[model samples]
Target: MAIRIKGYKWEFNLIESPEINAWCMPGGKVAVYTGILKITKDDAGLATVMGHEIAHAIAQHSAERASQMTVAQVGGGLAGAAVGNKSESTQAIVNQLYGIGAQGLYVLPNSRKQELEADKMGLSFMAMAGYNPQNAVGFWQRMAAASEGAQKPPVFLSTHPTDESRIAQNPRDLPEAMKYYKK
Candidate 1:
């Protein structure tokens, strides 16, 4: 399926967590938590989520983030009191910049440009696989419902919020996607 959709064959593994998560590692490796299967419901939803995951690989977002973090660390080291060695203040600034201050680590969020690019790419992949791109809406609706009232929404939803604009705007891709649908 990954090959059909993303032009890359994939290998799968199981993860023991209730995170409702999945990712496509750099080398066509795919790991999907059992927890997500409930909401995926059918092949179309699974393909939607998988396509999005594959987009991360295609766009090299993970590598881009690692590069940014490496540059930031290097810059901090050169700036003054050896932040690279061990400096609490420098680490704090880096953490905040990377959105990981709360965890005392470096975490990066995808830029809005990257997010939109992934959405378009994923939609194209699903369409290429003969999944109705409209099903992407229902997939996210289920995702949003699954996260209701949580202190923090799921990480996936945190990054891909189901705002009015995103929802209303997404279906517009259907005309483009339908051209690829076989059924």
Candidate 2:
């Protein structure tokens, strides 16, 4: 059956892996790693993750990220030239500064925003698809617990929102998402 989200054709792939991860590529291609099923626990939890991934595609997050990276690269080059074109130390500093600045100023924040948007969109999608939107909060909480003690970059340098932040927003978003729930 054709899905409610229109325009692009959707394809799902199941991959065997031990890493708890999933992703949606541009043009509605999606992949779910077997390892994530542990956290998903049930069909509702699975719907939560699936909706989130699909929402990323619906929002065109991949294209926006690529465009942002291109801009950041060009801006970094210009900033480097402005600082110093000659000294090796200056070049190194510029590179480091660019990495910090790009991530902190643009990339990380944009990524977090996209994540939140996807969460909101996903909540609605799952609710409309006959899954309880409230389950999303529990799913994220489980995901957070699963990743505890694992090495992770600091929030400023990371792309996705921190688990605490993601889970915290769910209750706030639940009311709206519930409106779309059919059963």
Candidate 3:
């Protein structure tokens, strides 16, 4: 696998939890809940999850998000500073609008964009690691089934893209990921 982990120390842990979830934190910390193992079913399936999470860390999604939030906060602070001399009600209104505008205009949209990017990169990484990227589709399918009865927010309000959307996008990503496969 040519996926570089040179600069950062990577750690992977399997947690004994019922939630079928996994994540990679910035700086290469990774956790996979045992419940997700059932859905993974095989090495390829596990690779899909690990690759996706690692891609997030590799892409520095958290750093991007933190920067974005910081910018939004600075904008809010500026706005509040400008309105410092105004009436209390005016200051309150400006702050409220800043919160809504910051989230709707940039944060939410960028979050969804990051998820798609991670999905693509993860697939490639999986293939490079000698796992068939095609197996990712089944992993996502099982994931969708696992959460079938759960409540999901509207796409606009959600941080992560829908599983169905991810599933749909997987095929488009596979050909590219296949290029990285050596065997």
Candidate 4:
């Protein structure tokens, strides 16, 4: 099936990995690991995953993230330089503050927004493609459960939305997404 994300001539690869991961790279390269299929369990579930990944590419999220990181790094460097005349302990404190402030004020929030955007757009895409968008909720719930015992960075430091946040928003978004469904 041709995914209709603009500016992307999609190509897909099935990698033989046990990792439950999938990604869409710049220029429309997509890869899915076999392991995630175990969780997906059905065509609609798979569509949920594929649609989300494709949405990332369609939104040019990677480029935006890189740009944000570059800006943060430059700003951090400038802040560090301005504090160079301070004592060593003061310099360390400034560095830590910069790291935390940049992450909280820009990076993590942007990432969470991107994830939410992808969720919304992916649901619409799947609905347009005749997949049931409601399945997304179940798929995400399963994904969350799967990660329950795994160690993850705190939400403020992580790039993706916590599973709980993602799941919580699905019901609210599903009604809008279903508007795109043909049947």
The TM-scores of all predictions, comma-separated, are 0.69, 0.92, 0.91, 0.90
When summed lDDT is taken over every stretch of 10 residues in candidate 4, the lowest stretch is 1-10
Candidate 1: residue 67 Cα off by (Å): 1.5
Model 1 weakest 10-residue run by lDDT: 100-109
Q: 8-119 in candidate 4: lDDT tens per residue?
A: 7789899999999999898678899999998899999999988898889888889999999999999999999999999999999999999999999899999999999999
Cα lDDT for residue 83, model 1? 52
Instruction: Give the 10-residue window scoring lowest on summed lDDT in candidate 3.
Output: 1-10
- For all candidates in order, the CA lDDT equals 0.68, 0.92, 0.92, 0.91
Error of 3 at 131 (Å): 0.9
Instruction: List, residue by residue over 44-140, the lDDT tens digit for candidate 2.
Output: 9999999999999988899999999999999988888887756888888888988888989998899999999999999999999999999999999
What is the C-alpha lDDT profile of model 3 across 1-183, one tens digit per residue? 335446678999999999888998988999999999999999999999999999999888999999999999999999999999999999999999999888888899899889988889999999999998989999999999988999998787788889989999999989999999888
Over 65-166, each residue of candidate 1 has an lDDT whose tens digit, in order, gives: 678667667655454343556577776776455444311223323443456566667787898988888898887778777866768644443455344435
* Candidate with the larger TM-score of 3 and 4: 3
User: Considering TM-score, where higher is better, how would the candidates rank from best to worst?
Assistant: 2, 3, 4, 1
Error of 2 at 167 (Å): 0.9
**For each candidate, how many residue pairs have backbone atoms clashing (under 3 Å)?**
0, 0, 0, 0
